[model samples]
Every structure is written in C-alpha cells, then in structure tokens.
Target: MTLTSKQRAHLRGLSHSLKPTAHVGKDGVTPAVVRSLLETFQQHELVKVRVLENAPDSAKSLAHEIAEKLAGAHVVQTMGRNVTLYRPDPEEPTIALPR
Candidate 1:
C-alpha cells in the first residue's frame, strides 16, 4: 500500500528515536542486507536503517532501492546518514496515521 504524505510524516516522527535496525556498510544493499531489512520490517513496522561512510551510495537513493526491494515498504524520510522505512504490518497494525 502506498502511504500518504501525512502517513509518511507520521512514520518519520515515530522513527526519530529508533536506532538503526540494519546498517548498509561496504556491502551496500546486498541480498543479505535486504533480507535483514525485510525481517526488521516484519518485526517492526517502522525501521531505521543507517548508511555507513563506506557505503558507495547516498542514503536517499539507497533508501529508494531498499523500498523497491521491499514491495509495499516505502521511504518515510532520509536524515543525514539515516533512512526510515515503513511497511504496515498486515497481522497487527501498530501505527495510526493522521487524516
């Protein structure tokens, strides 16, 4: 599902305090990293991923790639080296988006 701008804003606010669940280092956005990202999304609807300095790509572009690989998952925000992604949990929804 595509998130509205408000929903994306909400997710960005919620993920502020969250630590990076997955780090993309020199390996970049590999399959293993993608798996970890998917797993993290499964466990937590909102995930914060960090792009290390060794990574060859920018956080913004890398975030887009990860989101594409994650199906419904979308990039909420990219701050510095950190990127936040949100994928609603089908079983149990934790975040309530504002209208």
Candidate 2:
C-alpha cells in the first residue's frame, strides 16, 4: 500500500528518535541480513538501517531494494552512512502513521 504525504511525515518524525536497528555491512543485503530485517519489521513499523561505507550499493539503491523485499514503502530521509525505512507493522503497531 502507498502511504500518504501526511502519513509519511508522521512516520518520519517518529523515526527521527530511533536509532538504526540493523546495519548493512560491506557484504550488502545478505540473506541473513534480510531475515533479520524482516524480523525487525515485525516489531517496529518504522526502522532506521545504517549502511556502512563499504556497502556495495548506494543508500538510495539499498533502501529501494529493502522496501521491495519487505513489501513496504521506503522514505530516504537521510542518505549518508545510514538509510531509514518506514514500513507499517502488520500487528501490534506502537505508532500509527496518519492514514
């Protein structure tokens, strides 16, 4: 599902205070990493992922790939050494982005 602008903005604000839950290292999006990310998504709808400098792909590319893998939408707010992704939790949502 696509997120509205207000929902995206709300999610962005919520994610600002959160630290990266997972980090993509030099190996890039590995199976193990993807699995971990999937699990993380279950708990936190909006999660920040740190991308190490050694990662093969750029932050934007990685964010796109991650969003696709999780079947979720992505917002590239920060594109430095880390990239943030916002995927609404399917269950037990702690924060609800504006619908």
Candidate 3:
C-alpha cells in the first residue's frame, strides 16, 4: 500500500517510542531476519528495524528490500541506521490510518 505524506507522518509518530524489533547485522536481510520481522508484524503493525554498521547496505535500501518481501508493507521512516516499517493485518488492522 502506498502511504501519503500525512499517513507516513502519522506512522512516524506512532513508531517513535518503539524499540527496534529486528537488528540487521553483517548478514543483512537474511531469511531469519525476514522471518523475525514477519513475526513481529503479527503483534504490531508498526515495527522499527535497526541496521547495524556492519550491514552490507544502507538503511534506506535495506528498508525497501524488506518492505518488498513482506506483503503490503511500507517503509514509514528511515533515520540514520534505523528503519521503521508498517504493514497492517489484512483481516483486522489495529492502527487507524488517516486519509
């Protein structure tokens, strides 16, 4: 799903206090990392993933790659080594996104 500036801003605020759910290291976005992220999404729509300095790619690229692998996921924010992602549950989305 494509998010407007307003929606992205809203999600950014919601993820501010959230700690990094998955940490990407030298392994980059491995299957294990993707699995963990998927599991994290099961509980929370907004998830923060931290890319370690040793990670192969930059935070932006890693975030985009991860978003693509996950169904209907979007990159909400990417700051420094931190990447915030959002993917609401298809059946029942908990977070109410503004138009």
Candidate 4:
C-alpha cells in the first residue's frame, strides 16, 4: 500500500527510537536478509535497517530493493546508511495509520 505523506511522517517519528533490527553488508540484499525482514514484519509493522559501509549499493537503492522484495513493504525513510521500512501484517496489523 502507498503511504500518504502524513502517514510516512508518522511512521518516521515512531521509528526514531527503534534500533536497527537488520543489517546489510557487502552481501547486499540477499535472500537471507529478505527472510530476516519477513520474520521481523511478522511482529512489527515498522522496522529499521542499517547498511554497513561495505554494502554494494547506496542506502536509497538498497531500501527500494528491500521494499520491492517484500510484498507490501514501503520505504519510510532513508538517512545516511540507515533505512526505515513499513509493512502492515496481512493477518493482524500492529501499527495503525492515520487516514
């Protein structure tokens, strides 16, 4: 689902205090990384990912690749080597978005 600017901003605020749960290294966006993110999405609608200096691509590109890999995920924010992603659970979403 596409997020409105307000919703994206809300998500960004919520994600500020969160620590990165996944990391992208020189391996880039591997299947293993995608699988880990899928597992993370099961528990939370929003997730933060950190890209190491050795990563193959830029943070924005990696974020998009990550969002593309996950079925309904969206790129919420990308700052420096960090990326915040959002994907509401299909069965029972945890975070509510503003209309």
lDDT of each: 0.89, 0.77, 0.94, 0.95
Model 4 agreement with the true structure over 35-95: per-residue lDDT tens digits: 9999999888999999999999999999999999999999999999999999988888878
Off by over 4 Å in 2: none
List the RMSD of every prediction in angstroms: 1.2, 1.8, 0.6, 0.7
Ranking by TM-score: 3, 4, 1, 2
Please tell me which predicted candidate would have the highest lDDT against the true structure: 4
TM-score of each candidate? 0.92, 0.84, 0.98, 0.96
Per-residue CA lDDT of candidate 1, range 45-96, in tens?
Answer: 9999999999989999999999989888888999999999888888888888
Model 4 clash count equals 0
Q: Write the per-residue lDDT of candidate 3 for residues 1-99, one digit (tens) a residue.
A: 599999999999999899998999998899999999989998989999999999999999999999999988999999999999999998999999999
- Model 2 residue-pair collision total: 0
**Whole-model lDDT, model 3:** 0.94
Best by TM-score: 3
How do the residues 53-79 of candidate 2 rate in per-residue lDDT, one tens digit apiece? 899989878887877787764763665
Instruction: Give the runs in model 3 whose Cα sits over 4 Å from its true position.
Output: none
Ranking by lDDT: 4, 3, 1, 2
Error of 4 at 70 (Å): 0.5
Q: What is the lDDT of residue 96 in candidate 4?
A: 87
